[model samples]
Target: MGGDLSQTEVLVIGAGLSGAIACQRLARAGIGVTCLEQGEWNPRESYPGDKPDFELQALGPWNANPNIRRGKADYPILDDTSDIKPLLFNGVGGSTVMFSAHWMRFLPSDFFTYTLDGVGTDWPIDYHELEPYYLQTEADIGVSGLAGDPAYPDRPEYPMPPLPIQPWGEKVAEAHDRLGWHWWPGSNAINSRLHQGRRPCVQRSTCRAGCNEGAKGQADQSIWPSAIAAGAKLVTGARVARILTNPQGRAEGALFVDEFGVTRKACADIVVLAAHAIGTARLLLKSVDAAWPDGLANSSGVVGKNLMMHPMNRMVGFFDEPMSSWQGHWGQSIYSMEFAETRAEHDFARGAKWNLSPTGGPLNAALYPLDDPQPFGVDLHDRVDKWLGRSALWGMVAEDLPDSHNFLTLDSAHSDVDGDGLPRLHYETSENSKRMLSFMAKRARESFGAAGAYEVAEQTLAAEIGWHPLGTCRMGNDPRNSVVDKWNRCHDIPNLLIVDGSSFVTSSCVNPAATISAIAARAVDRLIHCRSEY
Candidate 1:
């Protein structure tokens, strides 16, 4: 539980995608980097093979008792008035372990939100500025797909070819084309051609749970191994409580509780916080001191403000033919944006894109069609059986604008077993976001109808809780409106860098992982060049 802190050059707090990539880059640069993860490192063999076991690992065990336990200590969940539930990963690989492998880059327009559309703040850097880094990240991650697809930017074709399209995927693509929607093989981190000594995807339907076949690109399988080989150290079961700053107001180290429930300190010349959006913000707020009365980097008072979650909605359709939607990777096929650009011309509140998703297992599928159940028994079983393979589901991921009201704060009442306060999230869909959701629902219905679905049922608007959370510690040129600067260095604390979803100014319609990796890589490049002076 103890280590020599003086020898560490860079300390990364969280071993997620961003943290893993950053640590790798730092190690490649010959920097002595140490990564601290709150959960134990579960190897590929540790993943479950059965569906019930997979469900328990993926969603059930956490849901049954919403507390993170590292050995004997339990981290409690704080209840907030917000309708949305904050979900985050606490392990070494972080959410990348359970991610659907959708590695999509944000559109060019996603960066210049202010100049192009005037709805959100413009990024200090744009797509063109990040183009090279995006290409590097894609190559590093071994992305699988063809380039020259109109939906994505022109770049080198994916390092690996696209996975073999499933029958359900082909059907969904046909349906999308018939409805004049753009459809393409999704850019995935899963291997299609078995590059880098990893095997190709075996078409396992259980990607949401950890992948045992090494097809899905979790950091543990991809970046962590390389980082460790390059002399970087990864310390798991180390929960970072707060960043410790020197009197000179520079980040020197962190205060953390190790696996044995013992308080420890780790020092580094530079500290990078990559604990996703909520975790990063919560940690910053918890590091309050006399120099930083409000929070470590809250001079602008926007550390945990302007939180955004891309509220996701789904439309499930039942067909006469068997679609077999659950046979492939979680997000292997995507119906592109024939409608994503609608906001460019129309008066739409916001835009959305429909992507093909797994239809779920029997128990999960039954809940989707249950608006009101008829007489139970054989009739219900018959109805479920008939629609099992014949169903195709499409998810609409719409961008939710950043609002100051949607935020994360520490709850005084709920403290973890380690005596650390829990983060209580307060967020709801804005009126504008609700309108956009309705517009997207209509468009999804039209697409399903064109696909000749026997029954198209749009999901009811439940509480807006999604895995894609962003913009809590947004980066911008204006210090008053944002938490970090263009370089992602905290405005108030020059030595501390926040590189993750928390730095996103706006949540794009697509997955934010690619962008997050690109930004972290860019930040590392900056850190390397100015290390001697800083």
Candidate 2:
């Protein structure tokens, strides 16, 4: 690679959800922008299909645990103290390449969690501030869902109608209705019809392996392409090592190792970090300099503190009748947010949200809990017959609060192939999180029983991993306690910004892709509008 300076008005790191959006917004504003990404582009055609061995590929690199994935682009993480494994993709699209694409907005109460629930820190921004950005992101990504969900804020109709509700979805909806719970058609980032010139999903039910069709709302598919076309440069295979600052303590650019293992410097007028929670935190912690011996933006001494992950639990129900589990989208089932907020009667500060699916594909269903022995002969025949098209799985996501013990730091004992210090994540489920999971698991079993399942079984939570990592570089009003300010700019480094999930102060009890994108959009818009102030 040439040692050409990253000649741009703004340089963004990571080409994932937030990074892609930031680039698009900046480039569209006619400001020169460039994106530096560690991983290479994964062509949509390369996504795995529904073969017998197809599910194995997900376990290899798509499972979210870099250690288990062990791909060349993935970096190893030291998570011995964590209850959940970190699941993320390293390439252009980030984790959305394998995400379930359940696009949910954070409830109003989520913004005031600290004030209302007395648990997590309250976000500097709220749902109302992000509502318009949510709408814009939904249209840009072609989200499909119905409006008028009483459980959420009032918003315009979706870009398209909800995906066709299969019989399984209807069954789950009926069960929730019977239980007097609010079940709505899930808000999905997957296209229901041909919108934005992309073809509708073929109902592959293999989203985790990467969406072969352009139906899913991956950053690589939707945002990155537009940004590049609008004059944003995307430099892949550039793994950023540390952020560089000048004598005045403002961000100058970054030092990265190119794909050829050559060290280079890419300077810019402004630098944005959108490498997700762990990646962003790791880079900042590793950049120990003369002015700042701790990190680039560690003046508050909170660079890697307050890490959080949404604890998840799974419940499986085996029915006596066939349900044709293989046909529709795996994550397009009913979504219930009845327990998304905390109640005074409950000991936990926050509750959980759930989505129901048929655990699509024979191979995936065969390896449901991942520890069960493969049956042979008559046992195989019986197990297959019982679960092939007659079962449903409930994936419950419970909110986790930031704890002092749950944090990320650099591991001096381990380093990546590029000689960058590995991330040592010390995270464990909090007592409140455990209680929330237990309560949600009981509710899941009850729902299955009410849905007329003959047998309902709860999977042991040991195999579960934390999802939707957040809050390592949290934003707040207090500069002494937060890494970034309300505008997503580093308090210590005025020219530095963070536009990923790391800036989130609280993790709502839902998939956070939509929220992350909304924040990126809002941050870039604010930056451009207030550039003269800076």
Candidate 3:
């Protein structure tokens, strides 16, 4: 059977936020770029606000839909291993499709955690190096927040205004103020005002179900469109099986399977692995050949070693007043950075933020209360309905240290639906991580108490799951302890760049996407400058 093989100046695997930004930057530099996504190109109109569809996308089956799940299907986790669940997205925009749009850059101290606090690994590049790029990315994605916030870096003003504070936000802020905690409007990727061609957020609450209003700036609605408009080619439903390397051990292209399961080859002068942390590391580990038997860029055996995920726990509170928590952007509202800074003398874990998350609809709310095995009846329904609007839910996203034990390995028994062995996550929170989470949970409890919550209930740590997984393929100055260099180019394979959460050396206390995008932009600039040498 005949098949198609194509070539471009640069080939980006995964069409998620990082891949989309990389493609956009590369294409704007006059480079020929092609982005291959495992999921279809789902437009904004396809996302509907329905409980069943939302639950399906958040749970299974439809969860792999790029329009819904993003690139979650590429890396399935065995959440049943422990009580804690692991969430991943499968699709073009990846997890950004369903992410909370919490666009936060790590504090300057986050980069020097090990050096300053004597814990974890220090980032090869510091916040100063990434500050400019962070500003650029924030502007590019239309982040909304005020500058001069003590919790964040002193940066330029956000492109758009902050999302309107909700009743829950006001309450949280009041609690923080009373407790002497630092609180601010979270830097969100959702548009608060009109920017570019996108419309302002209409205060529609179901952002996880996919924003039909085109306000939340997922890659599909933001960078991917700009990249495609700038002459970049996006091929969806294409799964990259492995990276193709020359005899010199330099990456040349990739072997991919199309939607029809037809094997094809695409040669490129440069290959970028933006397939998230686990997927990128797995691809490198799977690309063994004559020159490198272990993996493509596994000379240091650190491709998947320093796997880190932000373990999160939620604190639910019921109030007598009507807050209507589910009335606006899912990620919109307030953030508390009171505990984000590390204190070596305090013997405390890293600080966590308490952000106001959307109050779930009927089905999602059911999952929470039903954890107690309560009988389903009118009492349950009445309780759920009464608490639904008045409840204020806050999530504690604490940092997890990178450990060899918390890693991703190929599951020998599990395979994709097509029988290809999918990468299995062999992750467990370290003792230190659990301790940190416990510390953060205690703080969350205090915050809830201060908020005058009538009944504050903290979920058990066993129910905590990591949504932001980072540092699977970290970048460093030396290849001995890292997968890629400071410029994000693989040490063994100079032409191969891994730009994503995978390149993070340390899991910061904040969300990773803003940092990832800034790093990708910086890498693209470096790649462009070194194009002639290549």
Residue 322 of model 1 has an lDDT of: 72
Per-candidate TM equals: 0.94, 0.97, 0.94
Better structure of 1 and 2 per TM-score? 2
Model 1 spans > 4 angstroms off: 1-6, 50-53, 62-74, 342-347, 369-379, 417-420, 462-465
Best by lDDT: 2
How do the candidates rank by lDDT, highest first? 2, 3, 1
lDDT of 3 at 518: 95
Instruction: Indicate which candidate wins on TM-score.
Output: 2
**Range of the 10 consecutive residues with the lowest summed lDDT in candidate 2:** 458-467
Tens digit of per-residue lDDT, candidate 2, span 1-534: 688564678999999999999999999999989889999999987787545566787767567677888777788888887777788889999988878889999999999988997878888888999999999999987799999999987899999999876777787789888899888998888999998888788887888778888888888997888888898999899988878898988898988888898988889989999998999998899899688888879888888888988878888788877778766676657788888889998878888888887576666666566335767678767767777888877888888787767899988778766565789888888888789888888888888888888877666454445557899999998989999988899999899999999898988888899999999999999989998644
Q: Which residue pairs collide, candidate 2?
A: 64-87
> Candidate 3, residues 136-176: lDDT per residue as tens digits?
88877778877878886678788988997787778778888
Q: Which ten residues in a row have the lowest lDDT in candidate 3?
A: 64-73
lDDT value for candidate 3? Answer: 0.77
- lDDT per residue as tens, model 1, 1-534: 465345488999989989998999999999889998887676777676344555445445433223432222225445356655555556777877777778888888887766777777778988877888888887777688877778767788788888766665676678778776788877788888777888788877777666788877877787788889888899888888889999888999898888787888999888899988888988888888799877888889988888887776777777788766656777556656766653655555446666776676565565453434542587768657755767767777776778899887877677755455677778877776677778777877777777777677666453423567799899988878888888888887777888899999988888788899999999988898888745
Superposed Cα deviation of residue 404, candidate 3 (Å): 1.5
